[model samples]
Target: MNPLLTASGLHVTFPGRRGGPSARAVDGVHLDIGAGEIVALVGESGCGKTTLARALLGLVRPTSGSVGFAGAPLSYASRDLKTYRRRVQLVLQDPSGSLNPRHTVYDAVAEGLRIHRYAGDERAAVAAALSRAGLRPPERFFLRYPHELSGGQRQRVVIAGALVLEPELLVADEPVASLDASVRGEILALLLRLRDELGLAALIVTHDLGLAWNIADRVAVMYLGRIVETGTVEEVLSAPRHPYTRALLSVLPESGAEPVVLAGEPPDPSRIPAGCRFHARCQVLASGEADRAGVSSACRTRDLPLLDGHGRAAACHVHGTP
Candidate 1:
């Protein structure tokens, strides 16, 4: 089956001053989210995860490439684009900030219906939205303020707001990052259930690989604004081939290693290095470059491309051969 959403060769950059270098926030990002599938975009902060999402939502226009929703190309002025927004909603990381403090839970959840002009009585729609979000006995939450509810409840209200529109796609950006660990699992489970029950295709942007391991059908590992690895959860997580992917997996706590220490920080978007952006921090265990760390010259000079292997693809010269 064709993907529900497809982003090909997406590139987004902010123009710098006449002489200054422009910032490359997203570079050649290609992704495909199938119907009813949950694809996780995992990366560190400032890695353009949010930028890619905004491009997908048409909130930010891409400098190059295309974003297709369903089967048609997504254009800013296209009628399909407007319908796509309603069919694809975003649940922000911070429910408190996303919802208006002054608006009661009912108003927040029903806002989508109000905007979309969904038929029937507003009150009935409001209560139904609450019920669907698991805020059962919907009456209780309808009258409650955002501050009056718990973190999980506030998030549910946010989800309900998105669901109220009956969207087929949901872009959840760091949905559980701010919540306490105890509640994070519950929220993640709720998101998963929504997909299973409502057939929602979700693009979950998160930094935690654990979250993706728990909920995603596929995982895409991004580094320096590019997708370094992509595959099913088992293929990418169990046997990640990219040096960056390996480094990330090495420090996963459960990777059974004594915390693997990575060298240097991620490259600045404005001054990205030539060739392989990750060369600055890589340590090819068997390549005799383990001691160089950030000081190594080989990493600073070489470029790697996503190579097919073991039922997945990873961009790392070291793992691509032998």
Candidate 2:
């Protein structure tokens, strides 16, 4: 399938203060989001997941590498990139924090439409956008303020704002992380419904594997700024190959498995280990010898390349079959 957006060798680094070297946030990450597909990017906090999302949207200037939208290198100055922004919108996680306290809900959702100079009637566009976002009976929400709406309502307004642009892709950064668990499911369902109704392609950045399991068509597991594993939702959740991926999957509730709580925190980006970044906490490598099937030793001390195995690509040396 032809990709709607393709980013290759993406790298982002923040210069350390006091003349120290820069810290890598996104380290040569590559990703593709095809039309009408939902790809979930999952990882723990501080893993640079947000940075990657920003890079995709061109909000962050990558220290190195390029982003291509619809087969052309994205150029910030070009009308194409502006159009791209309109076509590829972002639905941020915190609606309460994201929305303007003073702006009426109608103004919030219509903001994008106004910015993009959408057709003849602005009010009609605003109403259409709000209706599509499930703020039904649009008039009810038009005069409502952010503080007046429920958490779910605020988020739906945010989604309505993004949808107003009629984007081809949506990058949602932990869209439901702050909501009550009860509302999380509703938000996910809303996104799924939008995808189906609008034929939207979405790249959902989240930490919860369970959420990915429920809504994503495919899952890409990220760790320390690089993607460690990727496959069909079933392949990844059912039998993750990378220790990090497996560990993440294990931690989800009722997975019928004990979470592998690898000891130690993720290494600082500037001080990443000599080999595989996860080696220090890798249980397979802690034994100091290759296990019976030669599966344990290399999860450490090797810069494992993502290779095809178990129907997807994984970066764990122990699990890459070929």
Candidate 3:
């Protein structure tokens, strides 16, 4: 199947303060989202998942590499970029912050339509989007403001805003990170329904592995600025091969394995260490498992190759297999 969106050898860099070295926020990431598919990009706070999402959406032009849509490389020209943004809408992390307090619920959801200069029945479009987002009898909430709604309702408004655009792909960054557990499930299920009903594909950026298990068809594990492992949800999460992935899962309540708390320095994009960016905090290397696998030296000295478009792959010397 052809991918609806693709990022190839993607890199995003931010200049450091006071003429310091540059920070590589996204380093050589290759990802794809098939039509109507859901892929989760999972990592810790500063591992560049958010930056990757922004780049994919054309909000931040990549420092290097390319983003493709529907088999063609993306063009950054103003008109072209606007069209891309319309086709690929973003659902941000914080609904409270994303919505304008001054705007009524109807205005909030209709904002996209107005911006895009929709010539169709604007009120009907807004009502349909709100209803699809589970805001039943949407007309009742039309005049309400963001502060008047619950956390979940605010999030629904945000989703409705994106849905109003009738986008083919939704790049949602931590869509449920701010909501309560019960509300989180509702949002995830809503996304699934949107996919089944509207044939929308999504690239959801989040730190929660459990969310990936519940919502994604495929999961990509990121560390520092790179995606170190990726595969089907069942393949990667069920039998994780990368130490970083294993460590993440170990911290979960249901994971019976001993906690694999990462030690040493947290990831720094400015000075990503030589060799495996994750080697310094990898429990597998610390446990002599890499040595037993006869790849300890390689793990500390050489960067693992970029993951291939294979069934399942890990970017670790000891676990570099598909």
Candidate 4:
């Protein structure tokens, strides 16, 4: 199936401060989201998951590389950009911040239609969007203000705003990070429902591996601005191949394996390590096992490709080999 959104060799860099080196927030990421699919981009905070999501949404232009939507490369020219924006919506991490405090639920949901110059019945569109987002008897919430609703309801409003535009893809950055733990599952289930019922594809940026396990069809593990491993959720989560991926999974409460506590913080993106970016913190490189000499050398000096020639892919020299 053709991807609803595609990003290839996407790189985004920010200029340095005080003549220091530039920060490469996103580095050579290749990603795709098929129609009706939910792909989780998981990693530690500051690993560029949000930056990559912004690039995909065209909120930030890439320093290099291309992003294609529905087979056509994204065009930043004004008219094209406006059209693209309508089809690809963003749900930010904080609904409290994303929604206007002064705008009532009706106004918040209706704003997109007004901006897009939607010709349909504006009231009907807003009501339907709220309904789709799980705010049933949508009228009950129409006059409510952001502060008037609970955190979960506010998030549903944000989602409703996105749905109001009838977007084909949603780039949600930490959709549940700010909500109570009790409310997180409800929001996740709502997203899954939207996909199953409306065929909306989503790229969810989150650090929670457990969330990925719960809802993602595929999981892309990001480290230091690159995807180190990507595969079916079962394949990647059940049997992760990348050292970084394994380390992440090891900490999961249900893994029943001792947590593989990594050493050292992720290096500054401006001074990303050569070869394998994770080599500095890789357990295998420090183990000094006699049989792992070749793998260690490669991990320290050679940049391994993300693809491992199997259904699952990992950017590790030792991955998939005996």
Candidate 5:
């Protein structure tokens, strides 16, 4: 199947203060989202998941590499950029921050239509969008301001605003991270429903592994600006091959196994560790066991590429060599 969105070797860097080295937020990453598919981009904070999403949406220009949509490259030139923005909408992390506090729900949802110059009736479009986002009796909420609604209702308003654009793909950055735990499930279910009902594809950036397990068809584990592992939800989460992935899953409250506590924080992006970026914190490399697999030197001294084999891909020297 042809991907609706594809990004390859994307790198985004920000110049440092006082003439220091640049910070490589996104370092040589690649990803794809097929039509009607839901892919979860999961990682700890500062791992560049959000930066990659912004690049994919054309909100952030990459320092290097290309992003393609529907088999053609994305061009930032005026009209093309506008059209791409219309096709790919972003659902931000914080509903309160994303929505205008003073704007009524109807105005919030209709703003996109006006900005994009929709030829259709704005009221009907807003109504349909609100309804699709699970805001039933949409009329009841139309005149209410952001402050008048509950947290979940506010999030629904944000989703409705995105739906108003009728976008083909949604780049939702931590869509549920700010909501109450009870509200998280509702938002996730809404995303699933959007995919099933509207045939919308989504690239959800989140730190919650459980959220990925709940709604993602595939999971890509990002660490220190790179995708360490990627595979179907069952494959990556059930039997993670990468040591980083295993450590992440091992700490899940329900995993039963003792949590594998990683030592030290992730290295700074400006001064990334040589070779395998995760080597300093990798328990496997610290222990003598990796030597038995004959990949210890490679793990510490060589930059492992994301090797694809079997049904999944991982950037680890000792993967599948037990």
Candidate 6:
């Protein structure tokens, strides 16, 4: 894919607290976000979705592998990194936490411009960004604080902060997770509009499959710091090949399928299991399906090849067979 952002064999490791095993926060991840394309990085907590997004945004250095932007490999040098970050921005999950209560909306949105030493009219840029983010009558919010606006409005302000810089890519971490149900749709629509109008690509980091279904063109299902499935939304969500993906979808209130209540402990980054990394709780293996297919032993003993996170694929021995 001709992508605006790309990660190849990306791995980010953090030493465990108290000298425990190092946590593989992001391990061998590969992803591509094309211009105007919205790719959802879906996974539960500690599955490394956020860490992967941080790596892509150049917030954290990868322990191994590489990140590329606009066909050029990411540079970590001070000046180059600053330039690189200016083209990519992050929208955090909580509007309340991301926004500075001490700063007025104007100051919050203008912070990036000030940091980048923008050369144009700061007031006009802030107004244009706020308007672009759907905060109409931009001056109305110039004096407001985070507590003065609704959750949706606050989120719009946060988005405006990112847009002020005119970034090519937005890595939004659960952009609407903190909003009320009625407000959630608004934020999702805003993201879509930004893409359609400005040709801005986004990697929305969320665990909500339903959200991915509504806003994303593509979905990458991550588990234990590795992508197990990747494809167009219709392909992966409608016909999910990975067992973990299937389980996640089944739990959605609208899926109608019986919920696949996963047994065993949740995935641990500090001590990842061998084999499928998901084999311990796989329904197919527990139901004797993998055994019938003669792959149960492999699922417990063999690790699947690292996924390049491209095309319609699943990295499962029984289902995807990579």
The models' CA-based lDDT, in order, is 0.83, 0.84, 0.91, 0.89, 0.88, 0.93
User: What's model 2's TM-score?
Assistant: 0.94
Q: Residues 221-300, candidate 6, lDDT per residue (tens digit)? A: 99988999999999999999999999999999889999999997667788898888999899999999999999999999
Candidate RMSDs in Å, in order, are: 3.0, 2.0, 1.1, 1.7, 1.7, 1.1
Write down the worst ten-residue block by lDDT for model 5.
Answer: 303-312
Judged by whole-model lDDT over C-alpha atoms, candidate 2 comes out at 0.84
lDDT minimum window of 10 residues, candidate 2: 302-311
TM-score of each: 0.92, 0.94, 0.98, 0.96, 0.96, 0.98
Alpha-carbon runs more than 4 Å astray in model 5: 306-311, 320-322
Q: Order the candidates by lDDT, highest first.
A: 6, 3, 4, 5, 2, 1
- Selected candidate, larger lDDT, 2 vs 3: 3
Clashes of each: 1, 0, 0, 0, 0, 0
Which lDDT tens digits does candidate 3 get at residues 1-322? 8888989999899999899999999988888889999999999899999999999989899999999999999999999998888899999989999999999999999988888899999999999999999999999999999999999999999999999989999999999999999899999999999999999999999998989999999999988888999999999888998988998888888878898878976667999888899989988889899899888898888877776434689998887783
The sequence of per-residue lDDT tens digits that candidate 5 reaches over residues 211-259 is 8999999999999988989889999988888888888888788777678
Encode model 2's per-residue lDDT on 1-322: one tens digit a residue: 6688887888899988798877889887878888888999999999999999999998998998888888888888767667889989999988988999999998898888777777768888778888888888998889999999999999999998998888899999999989999998998998899889889999999999999999999898888878888889998999888788878878777698877887989988876676677778776677554466575545545576533212488776666446
Q: Put down candidate 1 lDDT per residue, 1-322, tens digits, no spaces.
A: 8889888889899987786898889888888889999999999888899999999999999999889988998978867567778989999999999999999998888888877777888888788778878898999888899999999999999999998888999999999998999999889889889888889899999999888899999998888888888899998889877777777777777887555567768988989897667776666743565434342454456565533212367775555433
Candidate 2, residue 58: lDDT: 89
Clashing pairs in 5: none
- Please report how far candidate 4 places residue 278 from its true position, in Å: 0.2
lDDT of 4 by residue, 1-322 (tens): 7778888888899998899999999988888889998999999988999889988988899999899999999999988999999999999999999998989999999999999999989999999999999999999999999999999999999999999999999989999999999999999999999999999999989998899999999999999989989899999999998888989999989999789999989999999987899989987777764135566666777776644212467887777333
Error of 5 at 152 (Å): 0.6
Higher-scoring candidate on lDDT, 3 or 6: 6
